[model samples]
Target: MKRLVGLFAALLLLVGGLASPAQAAGTLNWTAGDSITAYTSAPTTATPGATTIVFENSAATGNTTGMPHTLTFDTSTEGYNHDVSLNILANPFDANNGRHEATVTLTPGRYRYFCSIPGHSTMVGEFVVTDGPGPDPDTTPPTVTAAAAGTQDANGNYVGTATVTVTATDNTGGSGVDKVEYALDSGAFQAYTAPVAVSTAGAHTVRYRATDKSGNASTEGSLAFTVVEPAPEEDTTPPTVNHALAGTQDDDGNYVGSATATLTATDDDSGVDRIEYSLDGGAYTAYTAPVVVSTAGMHMLHYRATDKAGNTSAEKMAHFTVVPAEEPDTTPPTVVAEVDGEQNENDAYVGRATVTVTANDTESEVASIQYALDSGAWLAYTQPVVITGLGAHTVRARATDTAGNTSPEKTVTFTVVGTGSDACEVPDTRTTVVIDGDDTGVPNADTGDGCTINDLIDEYASYPNHAAFVRHVETVTAALVAGGTLTKRQQGTIVRAAARSDIGS
Candidate 1:
């Protein structure tokens, strides 16, 4: 009975030793090729025991590119096991024929593993180790979705480059996601960290996938996009500038009182940014409205413009002159009035007459011109004034200048007469007379009654007074001379005889 108890105690001690974690040894394999993003194959789960890490990157192991690879366990990051210390570098050209191995005792936790190569950050993965038994093994793969981003054109094509972003999510109670990878345009898969930028200008496709720590991979997700060239360089051309001068001007090309200068600027590509101007030789100022140059002198309006692209136009200028306001007009205007008519033999106008008035000013423009007929009230004169009464009449004219100065009055006078067949009658005293170019040798007065000078004076020389009788005698003599009834000498002798006889005096 003492021997049996001793043997049982020994067996119990042996079983307790075997029950400790990391008693058994586990062999894990990792492989890589010419790719820098990830290893071709990797183990995701292991039992808590002495782990033998085997990494290969040789020709026989499909590493035809002869690129180097490493299997290194991370000890710095959180949320992962840090007890294991394993690092193995292998390549086809190395002495070990691209095969390397390391031994590490692993705890019952998660271990983060990756390639230590500088550009192989995406070659990261996670492996879980359990003592003997744990919860149900995680078998569900992580969900992965990809999206394309950049500035897009109207047709959804990227302007310069297209960026691809991949996101992944693992199922609840499942092994955490290991790594995200993407294949650009059907090329080799590369590990994803930041957004992947594709600059080639053409149609492209990115296939993405995510793997969990349980070695389950999600269904491949693809993103399609088109990259286009970027927009042309910014506009380097400056804006065009011009100006217009507007106002009343004199014949000498000088502005009256004030001149208005308006500026305009245009740019076909970037559009105008701003327009600036300087009056005369003053400082430049932003041009918002028309600049009124009221100061009297020769002036130069300088103007220029700038574009949004920082382009500045050459300065341009317009030259003009403004006349000063004139002094007040103290001198009045000058007016002239005149009458026009036809006169009879007695120095009397035959019928009507016309009166004309004119005005002039030296310092100011004529504002109004007025005229009055006889003693009538003054009225504005637009045309010549007419007088139809058969009598004497007068016209007066005046004018006012733009300076409110009235001119002195001016006047003109004229007389008019009536016309009739018997206005002046005369008696004939001759033995013979010429009527309508025919000679009648007989007495012309009282139906062939011969009359002498004495009869001429006594028969028709009666009048209200001496003046009337004298006028009749003179008229009879004048008619006799015109009709050829008597010679000029005889008519004079007859008139003298009538004067000597003195019928009325």
Candidate 2:
């Protein structure tokens, strides 16, 4: 028995020695959420090798709106590496739960990446991959140096302020410098990306160091400088601010359509810091753009400006009159309702019905649309209404104009015939609940896939998280209520039951 055990252990060791080693994967992570203009974090430099790319944009990462963003490598742009084809669309609701990864081999070059979504032209960056580690190891550290720049006074002290800049250089045939760090007055060291500015009226010391990609760190270097306060100037004059109104005027000196007011301020000694304006004696607010007044009446706009020297200009007023357009809009909006779906031989919809309400007003324009399903209470309509229950349905819709005129109601009727297998009966699970003011069968879960309540709830296990599952339940229940499949009370009961379940959680 001992001989047999020794022989087995030797065989195991031989097998382990002969096995192939796993490939080294270099990981590069990126994040973008709640922003349309730029990525929250991105990689600027990487080493050439088998790279694992990761991109994430999710609710936990700060995307509350569930907006999608794409990270697409530029293949058509000139002067960029196109070796790897990568395009990833990420959002909180995507299939991969807003995180995606891919494996690719990277070469030494500059790769350009950007968001392909329209109106996101500012989201662009470059990834530079350096050459792989050479056969000859690099052991030489990088050399760091620091310098100060400022106007010197008679006492050799800098005038007003001093700027300190650091530079690092690697030895010949060595790994490139990775990062530079600096410390102020023996404080904690921080990654240095820009010049350091010191304005205090005293002597200061800046210590800096650099590290190379090969883990070689250079010796710390230091730079000392002194700053002296500059003489102050006296200017008590306030800034001058003026306003001008621009618009087409009628024969009676009344502006037609609208009037735009522009405020201009100038200060010779101290520059203007801010400008504020008030319309119709209202609260003063910061002025950012030209204010346009289109109301059909006379108006007064007040404006003032403040300078950096603590001087404020007196409030000035501009008077103007704006008349309405030639034609008045007193007509109500025209509305129509239509039912659309896949119809069977009897003209009844197959499983579901869709109702669309449209309203148009060329004069004042439609301001809102309201719809009532099956003589129920009116609800604000933002999208097409979908109905799904085996029964006849009626949708009544109306529109309101910007002038507050309501249009006459328009009605559309439709029938929904189920496939006889879409819905299944599930037992009530909750011990105490109320639906439509009745306690009987209070928490029954309806299914369209012929599954039990638990089975149906477990279907959301494939989602990103429990919050996403809850959101889907809310969305589906709201639609069911709109379609008359479930009453508002029943929908609330079902949603509450789902939320209290531990299936997705």
Candidate 3:
């Protein structure tokens, strides 16, 4: 009996040594029907490192012929055969039926427990391994940071579509990050699977948060950034260009002299950057001010304006001309003189005569007309000139233009004769004489109007009565010296004529 008691105690010690300790274990219960679900009061947490899991399968019905039930624990959340099984039962009455136990070495992490039967992974529960008492439960939420990748404009707004990348990290607890969610502005939250695209313009806010496996959610983190829609393709339309002039132009678009050309540019979108212009097909230059064109003949001007977006306007053209200054008039004027009266056969005038002078010019108007009689000073001719001399006389005329041009001098010669001299007979028995191709009578005393010393001298060379002619001339000269009607030159001529007639004393 002592030995038997000793043997029994040894058996009890062996059984106790093989049995699982209840201290480092977790009890989980689930009823398996068509699926598997956790019991109402199943323990969800266990001590870390070498924890024994106690599972109860209270499967009462719904087990088919080929379908079986088993308890499995693994890191896998799906796929029945992929998990490590703790215990499997072919039927509810089989070994370990309705109950299963497993000892697994686990770290501080969450694991999934499911039925290992085909199509039974959907029925599952979670088992968490934790460090022994002391540390609090995983309450530290994950931190999330969101960054955008894109260019920024001068206004500090993001240009175009920006790629928002969200990164979450859990550093405090063994529970890892479950998911990261992001919301744009006040919109609904969406799970972040990849980069988010933000394309709206103006100010925008991106809110993001991370939830850890322990159901702890981080405080909402937000990034405020401005989004701009690329500035509408950079205002591709160029500025319109218009050309203006500061002076009048002729019918042929010719300017009389110098003129300034101004360019005006306009843009409805982006403002004009600068204006460029070319003169007379020359190279292009910036248009800071108006351009002055002074050359003569045809000229061409090309201009264009560029906007801030680097778009250039279509080339514009303007045509014009500049005329040269008028030259000074240097041409001389022409003078014309005329006499108003009939002349005798000897080209002599017997009565009063009138002489008129006129001047003309092509470039400038005639300023004045000057006339001079024989051996006389020049006088301005305002009207016709009258001549009453009986002998040959000459009148000189000249003209001047407004440009200081003097015309060549012109002269007219004419002689005057009495009507009584037409007959070759004396008025009252006077002596007759022939001179050159004319016949005239000489006065006996030179006191009458029938003849004069001039007539005697003129006919002395052609007279057949040379002695008579000389006597008559000498008589007339003595009478003229007494009467003072003849000058010294006339007296000398008469003396020479008397000598030629061989009657000089």
lDDT to native, each model: 0.73, 0.75, 0.65
lDDT (C-alpha) at residue 315 in model 2? 89
Residue 321 lDDT in model 2? 92
**Residue range 388-472, candidate 2, lDDT tens digits:** 5446677899999988889989989878765555343543344434322334354444444443333333343455555545444
Winner on TM-score between 1 and 2 is 1
TM-scores, each model vs. reference: 0.32, 0.29, 0.34
- Each prediction's total of clashing residue pairs, residues at least 3 apart in sequence or on different chains, is 0, 0, 1
**Model 3 global lDDT (CA atoms, 0 to 1):** 0.65
Candidate 3 vs. true structure, TM-score? 0.34
lDDT (tens digit, per residue) of candidate 1 on 201-252: 9999999999987788989988898999888678999999999999989889
- The deviation in Å at residue 287 for candidate 2 is 40
Q: Of the candidates shown, which would achieve the greatest TM-score relative to the real structure?
A: 3
Candidate 2 residue runs with Cα over 4 Å from true position: 1-253, 256-325, 422-489, 495-505
Q: Which pairs of residues clash in candidate 3, taking residues 3 or more apart in a chain or in different chains?
A: 349-415
Off by over 4 Å in 1: 1-24, 133-171, 177-505
* Rank ordering of all candidates by lDDT, starting from the highest: 2, 1, 3
